[model samples]
Target: MARSLLPAPDARGPFSPGFWRSPLRGTWFTSVLGVVLLAGVTVLFVTGLLSYAAYNPDLSPVNDKTPDKGILGFYLFSWPTDPPWLYRLTQGVHVTLGLALVPVLLAKLWSVVPRLFTLPPARSLTHALERISLLLLVGGALFEFVTGILNVQLDYVFPGSFYPLHFYGAWVFFGAFLAHAVLKAPVAFRNLRRMREGGEERADGQADELAAPRPDPPTVSRRGALGLVGGGSLLLLATSAGRSFDGPLRQTAVLTPHGGPEPGGGPNGFQINKTAAYAGIRADETGEEAWRLAVTGRSGTVRLSRADLLGLPLHSAALPIACVEGWSTSDQWWRGVRLRDLAALVGHDGPVDVFVESLQRRGAFRHAALRANQVGDPRSLLALSVNGEELTPDHGHPARIIVPAAPGVLNTKWVARLTFGAL
Candidate 1:
């Protein structure tokens, strides 16, 4: 008889049987942490989809007349104007949880990192696939988190545009996540159920998976490990939540990273992402005498001076121009000609979409598209004034489009023209 000298295999099932011998590495601890991160990622995906759907770019009409290329305007649908905070809440959760996950995810990874160095990492084809799934899960998560945080900070150190890159990456990450979920579901469910039943189990009748000399006692008990993860999450929330909420955190500028003035500036105001100078808008172009809002439609084209627009029926609405950068101003006293009123100049009484062109000659968002609902909403306007006074050039000056439930960029500042057509 011959015996070979080799360390025994340390292979264990998912949730890793006898994982509790490592205390902090207990099945309950890892499963719970995984579940929280999973839930956060799931919410981010859903909210992101909702944000994309709100973009609502159209298929048929590219321009007032047949045009060369289609405008992706990305202004396809007017997200609900009611509950103006809808976008605010979803985007807020997306950013906040994303930030919070920084610590939570690190902790989960730290707890499970030992498995990465496990001897004989794979014992079979099935095990090999499982390890591959782990690779996808970790890689995808890191990519999403890092890119997402950078985006919130408006740091474009990456090679391509943030929108397309982050978007495609999301699909890849979620695909791997779904695959990994299927592989780990049974183990995860069993462990979760065991924890609920007071966690005393020899499930599947499998013996413990540790050697006689078990791994060193964990420095923290399972409950303590959970507390550490949870406490880290709470600290992140406390420090960063001020970006969305108002209070001392904002004044002191604690750990809050999303920095900008509170929405409400200008002459009696609303906070702005880009001021007039920063946007490279010339002061002369926004002058009342120099600016003429040209309105074109299926029927005809008409140009209106500032007074001409003011002479037309005027209305006011309190709307919030919520920025995706995570700031919002409510109850803005926006006064302007109803977008439908401008549409009427060309006989467009029915549902119509409006194309808003801005005076700013250069910049990424110099023009915007108004979806049908926005054009029809009485609240939608080629705003002549905000908060009872003429618009400051920085606030879209002679004329700008202020539509309900629209992103600030799509609100179309420094608006120079409006083109109308069938929905």
Candidate 2:
């Protein structure tokens, strides 16, 4: 009986309930969430780059004041559109994802608070540098999140232009992210390997060992406070996201006629006159015979002389020209005819793509091709006049292809020739 004594079973790893109670668990969760949050920021950054490349007025000085249209523009402004249900739903997801990050960031900060007491793993000159790097990263991340949220509210905190802050801050953030990654790479890799080899139990034990020792009486108070703060922040963010989903406030601008002497009627009412420019050509005066449109590519080569096009049925309509830069203007317009109709005149079959060339050929000549379905869209017009008057030279006078709801670049002003090809 005296020799029957035995030892008790071994205790569970550091990641057990006992271990998670320590401050280390909070730091771990925060670190993981930080990575996830950075991923979201990356997505927003890439989208901004694409928008800039697309000559988004919001980021461009040339047409920054112009009105914007198209799907990408709408997404940038977070505006509701014709597809009400679909728009709101997608926008809600975007806003919610953005806003949800706020609490996650806060929780991460809270978790990292206890790390101040503990010594960093590195003690060399390199380690000292790494510590400084981490501090800078934390500060930059905080600034990015704060400014980003303010941007969502349309509150421009920095003076001068929003572009400088948005664009320059991006590079700084990227540098910090890279530094953080380099510093944490080895530890992260080690932890991953240990987890993979030891399974859940070993991982849990490791977490427990890393956590701070709990004071007697089970110090659960901090956890409760964190839960409350995180919940409240999330709720606030969700409420804001809900409101944005309701749709943007509409503010209509008064219409003004900018051509020569205004027509007999006032701005409120207008009409389209076909005698004006169409396809950058007037009916009576024949331009250089050399000014023929050469259609090439998928439909084979077909040249349509100005006379040949004029013989086709001429149609005109007044439609709104909305630019992606947030400017909108309506024109009681005379256009050559429907683009789809013109395509038919040249025997344009299903597979043809369209590109319009301008006489000036200044700057970058805009080019776009429409899918078979997009060609027949009611809003597509080759405009000739605005408000019963000829278009001003600056406004793509003579003739411009106006695709309503498309970006201004795709509108193709001062069109002199047309070409068809595969997209």
Candidate 3:
């Protein structure tokens, strides 16, 4: 049997490997994993923005009434107004994605660490920037992931507002990532071009000398590896799926028998009434002819009458209405027709944006416009009832918009009219 010889460390740096060392398989694995994890982060960030845009404040009364309870309730504390199913679903996705990122990031760090000691050529300012950007990228990513996980686990126990940190940190993450990509663009392009031309540039020159060219190592058989990855992703998806189904998950934090007397009827009890309100709107004492839902902007001039709306097919959903505020309530049955169906009645073939106007006309209340996608999303609806009862005057008596999985602000209340036009 032949004995294997281990390479000695460099004289200059005790830990440094020879100049022409070979890149390890772990490096390739980490690189691929890092790219995938980065893509996941981008998706999560964009989706979060979309959810924010779709938020409907009208749907969140608790937040409006008790700002502190509302603020702390949804994200951290449990409140009477929190939407049971929706909150859990969003939280699950937020936390699970956060946790999944840990190992991937760790592997990436481990892969690139060896390069730090080698001190590769930094031929220009751009090269130096690229190196620095890589470090920042790693640091920012680690910071975001670690803080995010801790925030979720600790339920955001920081002294100040975690929102400021999370929100501002996102910009930093975005900037660092953008800088890193820009810095690496030229080299990446060149590397791609080289590969296309059958020219290889090994990270370590010794790859050619020490290791004979062999068929690429099967990182698990393709099908088997894909199965494993798919299985893991599916498991995550499954964990969140329960929230969408009608079960205990569908319940909200609001106490049952809403109108029933409580220890304190003021803030602790269910303050919003559901049925009487919807009935009043249907009666239209304000005059049915006067009621108009105006469509403005790109879709051209169009108006919907009361009859036109009622004529459309009605669909009811017991979906939870989660606010960014901490409190949650569940099983507040929503009875309404889908917004998409209503839009279609107006002959909307594609996307349409519209602003919602309320009758109240005071306080934090304000009009908001919905982009085409938000208005068209299947989960968006014009609610007529709450918990199988008609809406109460205090809770958008006439009509309200309910956007599942969105924050409270986006859900417009007392939807007197919808003006479709530029804001």
Candidate 4:
């Protein structure tokens, strides 16, 4: 049997007769595939971090009133408070890249699987670290992709809470990813430079080795494998992207539960996660007579019923309510008092973080912290009506907080009280 000309140590560096026999396993092939996978992973990681910041804002002391204190959510800087489409783009990339990565990851894994059985396994400390890094990259990638796919699908098949598991695991995965990138940089750069220079040509004997006698080598050619992988990425993107850009692609996004036009019809027509009935809230209980929106801060306390709230200055904003769940509403009209104006009544003129409370007695996101940017935005509102109609019970009846560039959960539905400082 002929062998590969590519230099290597002994067992699995690169020059193996068996490895050369598979046309798809060529060094050039592996290098190119690896680059694609790398790009996808890097994009996912960055967008993932941005999404985390949008949710956790770890660096801010503003979240003192909330639960889950000091959880590694230490991301400082409030996310953008304008261009309401901010998270739509970031989280959309995160989820779509996650879906698109499935095939690329599978291909990269398939190509590298043979190395796992290399005898002696560890030739030196660096080799051992390389193996450890590989394990982390594999395990972390699989765990994250699997959990992400399932989580976005709303499947809770995992043993524990998806939030903490996914969150902490990301840090580990990213650390390992960085270490692996540093380790592989040398080989990767050389291989890439060779490919770009048209130096991808193999030596005389190497190409012949692929045609040598071998036991059932892969019949699929390199181009075929890449085509399959690319096809898969395109297919997944087609089926998932509509949740963000719900237009002509909506029909293709069958996998996305929230991807179609607002199903409720008219003003109320839109995707809903938690329904009023499911939330154990009754129509009778939410009557305006019983409903009151309270505003409190450093200045004083003010209770405003629906009529009183409507009597104040009202502004309407065209904003999208984007969520971490990988879906977003089209820009809809929201009408209510400007949050900063509301804050001004409470003696907050300067930049300040406000604690928004909701009537939800039990739920993870009942309350949220709004940073100065969100509070001060003219578009941020104690929204009384959506699309020109009073909020439906499912849509945070009475009033809700709608801030540009804020996560839907952080928008604080069914708002009850507003405390402007550390309370």
Candidate 5:
């Protein structure tokens, strides 16, 4: 047959097999990284979904950041309050593991980067499909990791609201990730099995394109490269994991935001995501005389002043404030009327969904909703004080909602009104 009209496959630059010379760039090395990612990423995705459900996203319009989430949110459930530290654990793992896996993810990409430049892009229909999946997997992983780290650092340089973008991005990324994993898992497991069975080297006789045809002398052995990647992950874990704990370990959280000592000095002093000043809370509005909490429900509306709320039966619970940003306080001694009591004031003595409005004039979460379970949990409170001291303005002076196992924002600060019953 005569030569076709199509351009010859570009083999220059990265497309040339010679351009990749890393001796460690082989299927076994790549597969090992993939296997690690398979386990780690699965946990990350599950914890992430749990974090979303903890927001009670089913509340819709108010708590549902991804209203257009459609079938993606099918896994969401009424988040439980029994553990009290449930959200804390899930979110902490999500953020910390995501950070620690960065090194591994990078190494994995480096090992496979040559594939991105492969000439004659596809050899068959299946090859083309696999290529597409690979593209999405890499792109999705980078996008998710970068955006996640930015959020953890409290950096909002990225455009648009983080909630929807991250939420939707996760679904797309996970879809591609699962597809790629399904196709490659057998090869990865086989490579791992071979390594375990004492055939790590000089075993695979297959034509491995990942191996450089003219590789330079190895600077480090394959085992050394894996060690380097693992060590980097450990280093990251050491620097970032402490943000989830309280006390000296917190100092080790050098890479995470708000990992330092509690801001200011006192019982009430702890990490505050936003200050009253930042949230646009005027001194006059939150002052005892001016701030009256409006409670509306089956009994219609009734207003209560700070003193009035104080006069009602008071209770206390030790709960931590965990943020999506990853940092969390130790269990704080929180004192106030139980959320069920507040709901009771509105004639909702039983479990009932509650919509909470905040005095915050600027920023998201000025208002939030809690599922009936959250509202009814005996531990949930409209916190008036923390650690036996009245709340600081930054900690939601007049009043704040502190629900066990809820995301920090949903624990609406500077609370203004409570509406019980359906939204």
Candidate 6:
């Protein structure tokens, strides 16, 4: 047999080919995991982009989180308001699938870790480039996954804002991910085909750098290893996917922060991301005698009290509140005045962008801007009540904004003003 260029087994540490003792450490195993991630991460990237666009990031200085997105924003479009549950489904899949893929990602990394300690690091220019790409692929994956999990849990301990950090990190990570996938896809497919044709031993025989010179005795078959990874993924999915739903299934979402019985109870009880007190809502301000809504447009500013808003034509819609954090509420009976009606009162007779302001004293998204499509949706409302009861102080007592297919934060609790026109 031709002598391998890699260091002999007598060498110490990971630089020795014999140091990697797992019989499972071979090209076929790594290739299989790579193929699965190639398809999964692609879907994850696309849905993540869709989630960003749903925020109307084009509304600069208002709803835009990554203000300097530049060319990255090229694919952004006015997110549709139809289907009503569009954002809910996309974001739900994005978060849930992301968590479920953790085991596969970790296993893929383990299968290829020996490469990181290769002696001499690079044998040629092509080899050097491949090593560099691999480094970026691994580092970027870790950063994106860690930061994303923390964000979903509402942990902001990391440096920089979550929006911009995650946005830019995704672009860099996916760029390297695509490059690596393109370079290795042909070999991976070949390995998969060899295994499928009962040529598994032949495929293992042709193992490249991933094969250990002196592997340990096999404790489990390759198929068994894959089964273990898949089982772990399914376990995570069962515990995390329920946060996006309602009823008993929600209890299964023990992995999520908002999972378990609904917070509090009764008609007014559902889920409140931030309470009125937490938002600095004073008792005197939200009271019917004190609260007033300011509507502005071509007709100029017109202030209306809560009673006056009630006197206007009332409408109702069953809408859900879906947050970027991945937790969502079931459809609740919401009663209030239509956003279009409010726009008309301010002289905007047709679909036009609207800027919404809230009385929130702390935190991000105290105000938000909605696109014309969102404003045109007749289901959008300045909700004054839910489940047929008056709004609780925590639920935006006087009124709140509820736009179909919009993010939960953009719903703008404790709404104080509505400006109908180009945002």
Question: Please, what are the lDDT tens digits per residue for candidate 2 over residues 1-423?
Answer: 011122223324432234434443533444455565567656655544433333334432343422343333444431112231322233334434555666776766666554433332344787656666666666766766666556544566755455445545655666777877666655555564665587542465544333456634545554475576568656755454433211121111112111222233443232222113433344333343654555555446666665665566667665554322222334345556677766765677554456666665343334444443435655466665555565554455546776543444556665666665433
Ranking by TM-score: 5, 6, 4, 1, 3, 2
- Cα error, residue 154 of model 4, in Å, equals 1.0
lDDT of 1 by residue, 1-423 (tens): 011133346545432434434545545666777788778888888776555544443422322111221342333344665565677677777777777788878977876765664546566788777778778788878888888878767788876766666666777788888886776666767777875876454354554232212566567666887887788888877766666544334443365553334545445555565777877788777676787888899788998888888889899987766666555555578898898888888889898877777877676667667677778888888888887888886787878888776666778888787889844
Show where candidate 3 strays beyond 4 Å: 1-15, 18-27, 55-99, 118-128, 183-241, 244-332, 335-405, 408-423
Candidate with better lDDT, 4 vs 5: 5
Residue-by-residue lDDT tens digits, candidate 3, 161-209? 5554655556567678877556544544544454447644454343432
After best superposition, candidate 3 residue 183: deviation in angstroms?
4.4
Write down the RMSD of candidate 4 (Cα, Å): 5.1
**What is the C-alpha lDDT profile of model 5 across 223-272, one tens digit per residue?**
89999999999999998888887778888887568875657777866788
lDDT of 6 by residue, 1-423 (tens): 112366454656866777899988777789889999998898889989999999988874878888888999999999888778888888888888888899999999999888777766567888878777776788789888889899988888879999988889998898889889888888888877877786654555554678777888999998899999999999989998887777787889886877777777888878788998899999888887888999999889999999999999999999888888777888888999999999999898998889889988986899899988888888999999999999898888899988888888989999999998976
Give candidate 5's TM-score. 0.96
Model 5 error, position 381 (Å) = 0.8
- For each candidate in turn, the TM-score is 0.83, 0.44, 0.46, 0.87, 0.96, 0.95
Candidate that would win on TM-score: 5
Worst 10 residues of 1 by lDDT: 60-69
Residue 53 CA error for candidate 6 (Å)?
Answer: 0.5
Off by over 4 Å in 2: 1-27, 54-96, 114-122, 185-210, 213-237, 243-423
Q: Cα miss at 315, model 1 (Å)? A: 1.3
Model 1, runs deviating above 4 Å: 1-22, 59-78, 200-214, 245-253, 257-268
Poorly placed runs, candidate 6 (over 4 Å): 1-11
Q: Model 5, which residues run further than 4 Å from truth?
A: 1-10
- The alpha-carbon deviation from the true structure for residue 320 of candidate 6, after best TM-score superposition, in angstroms, is 1.3
Task: State the lDDT at 33 in candidate 5.
Answer: 91
lDDT of 4 by residue, 346-393 (tens): 888877778888777665667778877778888999999999898887
Candidate 5, clashing residue pairs? none
